[model samples]
Target chain A: PRMKLVLVDHNEFAQAVAGADEAEIIEVIDHHRLSGNLRTKEPIRFINEPVGSTSTIVGIMYRMREAAPDKSTAICLCAGIISDTLHLTSPTTTSTDKEILEWLAGIGGIDSAQFVKDFFAAGSMLREHTPDRALESDRKVFEENGWHISISQIEELGLEEFWKRETELQGALQALLTKHSLHFACLMVTDITRHHSVLLVAGDQRVIDAIDYPQAKEHVYDMAGVVSRKKQLFPYMSHVVTKLDAP
Target chain B: PRMKLVLVDHNEFAQAVAGADEAEIIEVIDHHRLSGNLRTKEPIRFINEPVGSTSTIVGIMYRMREAAPDKSTAICLCAGIISDTLHLTSPTTTSTDKEILEWLAGIGGIDSAQFVKDFFAAGSMLREHTPDRALESDRKVFEENGWHISISQIEELGLEEFWKRETELQGALQALLTKHSLHFACLMVTDITRHHSVLLVAGDQRVIDAIDYPQAKEHVYDMAGVVSRKKQLFPYMSHVVTKLDAP
Candidate 1:
């Protein structure tokens, strides 16, 4: 049977679940840039807002309908907001996100400050997983100007673990490039506590040389106060690819 | 100064007002197919639903906010609903449209049946306006597979006015094709009462030949029970344009 789907977090089919192209997309509630490729046989309800997280939009929807989620569901929603907005510190954080987070936190009976602390400490990607697995976590691929690129992001409490496995992570990025026949592949390790990140890239030399961010080392750049892949890194990378000399 | 725009009814930039490319689009409330070109520097509220009329969505929004429009506004909304959905008889009309129309009619103290009748009889485009003016009214341009096409629609009480000016409308469509350098241009004259339309087309011979609707004359096709430009004519024309052999 064909699945009837209501996509929540993302709107682009590339970021959606596998076989999403064949499935019927009945509705979409997202908080991302319109990818412009989504089409439906019939008009569907689409609600997209510019906020820190899709969770915030969902919470707003519930309030509009004069309803509230169950306690556990509220907690899950709170977690989503915290993770996406990094405890309301990320630049993508909006007034709506702040409002919705407070409402959900009250409903969930969660100490949001403690939840943020515990959430960041729960799983350190560099410590808990191999470089390959870390790179695959929360990864997104994009096609721009006929070049296919992949950008993977992993958030940790600090950058301590990233320095330890720098070489291995770079190797994994290279392997990813070859494995996927990508023009470029990048893994952004973000420190949520400090609002900083380090990008390790492996790709064509021309593309790499086009990097405008201050280089910390070979094939690595220090991205200070940059924690958002969607808001910060992706657009920068797209600009680089777009300005490159035709292949 | 760049205007901050709140686009209602339509989302595509092609159909938007001039200088829209330079303006800031802060919000959109629409019920059309996503044209995929809309982008914003900041996240904005976008609400799109598959409904017969944007007035229906506007009415629902008013209800959600626990508010009601004033008398004149209510009547205007009712007229929008009646005109777009052809008095709740178009195939595109949804249950929500019916519900909202009834609500607005009650609030505005409207006789919907009489209003619909008077509205259709008020301005017979074929009789009152020149062919050029008639074709430009309620017209939409679309680009598919490198083919730029225009489809203009005019609703009247019967086919009497259309038969009187078919040749002139055909000439105007040809002029529109040349003026815009379009691949094809069509004028759909719909008899709202009978729920039928006749399409007068002029453009590239290849594209003209590909249209499969039963020909009523040399350059006109009979379209029975077709009152919707968005739901019926646009998609069929798009399919025809997309399937033509590569130029």
Candidate 2:
């Protein structure tokens, strides 16, 4: 077998990608915040932007390449942004994020407003969610500076229900970490109304220590005003982790 | 059976509500530019603030009532604003609109970013859409100076598809006018990137005449650099119409 080539559950997706045939992992494009595990031997252009959505990142890449977002891609990416940022209602929304989304709508030839309604209706079927389903529904990969991490987001019914199921979600995530051999695993249980987050950590304490959020010491970071994982949380974590990891 | 409380399909579900006993209409609240066909009682609160979204008008009203949006109501209303203004990306977005949306979010206890994402995703699907769905999804309700009208918005789509489908959408809208006995009907197709709109007029010419776009001629009005239908379009139109309709 070819080194048992496989797709790992979360952060390992990037690690499994390392040292593979150059043709195999020729182009790596992701929109999640930077992870400490990413390294490439070949000279490949890496594009990352702090926008509301990774689909938005892809849209920007297409723009830089002077390529328009295709209809399907546009629809998918817009949905990603809508799903990720909650329609730019989050504090994470910047003028740049809005401008890129508008530009995407122009090239993608779709109405952003209409797409938002349709996309939300699809994702907001909360009545059908199990704790495991809720936990795994939205997972993102991160690779940066040789340490890989994966974070999953769960939008619960309310704060009470979120804590009620935190243990179950942690158990599921722990199983996922062991199964995937991820260096760091996290789940951000965001209380949308309260504007707070419970960052459940399951990995090396050193790695968690490296993240070193002023609010992380409680092991339950209250992102009271932290509305965006992309524009706010991810960028802060990336900088802190990099400074700590710097030799 | 009942007095058959007629309403244009473009009006919001709340705007056309009739009294349970008499089938008499209660109030008219709309943000679409003026239409001359509404015949209501002597007293009504015709609130129309054309800023960015009808939700803005409602927000202002809530403020006037000293009713701060609670966390749930704030998220829903904030979502409405973000959805209506396209995350404040619309040409219609104003500083006031942005400020108000932010204010409502703060009051409503939203995680702003997640709320936006959830709201956008809730409303962003537009694939395989018909002319009717395209036109009806974002309709605004209005009753102004005793004249009631509803304006429907179709934002950010391909010009080719819009042109191909506009005639049909217009026809359907005209059918709505007859059904509701509305005196005026307007359809606005907005280009988010270019900040322009193509205005289609039907119903009363006097009402159409009452509409103020000093630059307007026939159906091809130039709403260049215009973004928010609430802020830019309706305010200009209301000023002109109120001037023209002065009794």
Candidate 3:
């Protein structure tokens, strides 16, 4: 059986899926806040980093598996990490990422200047994706404090495309909430390269309004230097949850 | 549930396990040998490197986890890796190990000279175990061509003790062959600090006799500067395996 991607925040799900027959579980590359339960009986290869994206995780895996990462895998992983983390611009970018990036640039045959131009161009494909598609494409689901919430990372073409996608992103977020039966949904319309997250929260206005953050424009919250969901968003979200639950 | 050890070649497992359960796997530290199957389901703050021992793996984990490794754990891990890989003496030792050892030495509250003394002393417990136990403790299982083989390593004990333990080590090795159901077992007794492996083989005599290494001694094989498994033993073994399989 071939391997499939099992994106998880909890260990049991990972374990169950990994333990299942027909699941080769050949590789487990992840970047998230930690949760122990990564044990699998399969002869699997894994790469985990504290950086912003699984792309960085895959980059390291490619190097370890092949002793040298193939060009395509290297570029894809590098591009994934850059887009996910918003370059090294994300606050979540660690010394490890810096180290890995340097190594990746050497291995992946990347020209930093050229990569930046191509990367933004790929992410800035605003016309191709609906706001909902953009929001849903990179989403993670988890149960927080009692309510099940979904967080989506929405990146678009810089200032020019931001206003264009704003309404669509908002509608997409609402659609996702109803479709998924989520208590609430948060879309971080972020310019990772710019190191800022324009957080859009909807569904339960009570949940949205109850959370505290720097107001960008009323209900929209703006967080500076917030490129990584694991490092930056999760902690702030936890704080927001605490505030909402305050007696 | 408490976190169990989940060993991998990377950091993602460590972080994921840490998040899944409140039972923190606590420590993760590994030398990057690309062997072993370890599983975990709790945040196991781990440190893995292209080093020589899981002991060093734990030391780095200590630095990251509690922001400090206590005296015993620090000493144990330091000694473990040093003893396992002969104190960054092996060719397999990565620059990460060199860098981390330097950091660990400072943080673990010990000097380099003292660490070497303590680690070697603990590892060179030649008085405690028979030749076989000493030989088998640092064993690696490798499959080359069509045969499965086990390689055991021993390092830096006086000639007197090595000879004294030879008979016992041989007997223990015979038992290991039966226990593991291996095709063959090879012991590389190396004076890592001095650079040599007293190559000992058990199983098919044809396999042993077929090896045409110039320095090989009678009754007991002696190869000077054969300390690294990757650089030395692996090549020799691969060659020997090819010779044995040649029709």
DockQ, per-model, please? Answer: 0.42, 0.01, 0.05
**Interface alpha-carbon RMSD, every candidate:** 2.8, 26.9, 8.5
Candidate 2 segments exceeding 4 Å error: A1-24, A30-43, A60-70, A89-94, A106-111, A124-130, A140-150, A156-161, A181-184, A192-195, A203-221, A230-247, B1-247
On the 0 to 100 scale, the lDDT of residue A243 in model 3 is 57
Per-candidate Cα RMSD to the true structure, in Å, reads 3.4, 25.4, 12.3
Query: In candidate 3, what are the lDDT values of residues A46-136, reduced to their tens digit?
Result: 4445555566555544443446677776776677667655677676666656666777777777897789787787646456776766775
Answer with 1 or 3, whichever has the higher lDDT.
1
Superposing every Cα of model 1 onto the true structure, what RMSD results?
A: 3.4
Q: What is the TM-score of chain A alone in each candidate?
A: 0.95, 0.62, 0.76
Q: Poorest 10 consecutive residues of model 3 chain A by lDDT?
A: A7-16
Worst 10 residues of 1 chain A by lDDT: A34-43
How far residue B135's Cα lies from its native spot in candidate 2, in Å, is: 69
- Candidate 1: where is the Cα deviation over 4 Å? A1-7, A13-27, A39-44, A106-111, B1-7, B17-27, B38-46, B59-75, B99-118, B204-218
Where's the lowest-lDDT run of ten residues in candidate 3 chain B? Answer: B34-43
TM-score of chain B of each: 0.97, 0.55, 0.69
Q: Put down candidate 2 lDDT per residue, B1-247, tens digits, no spaces.
A: 5564433212333344445235643344544433333323122223333466667756765664457766777777787778777788875566767878988987877777787656544432233477667657766545545555667766654345556665676787788678777666677777654657777767767777665554454554556666565656555555555555532
CAPRI-style grade of the A/B interface in model 2: incorrect
lDDT of 1 by residue, B1-247 (tens): 6789989988877789988878888888988877766755335678997889999989988986679999999999999988899888898899989999999999999898888778777978889999999998899887777888888999988889889988888888888888989888888988887899999888889988998889999998999988898888887887887788654
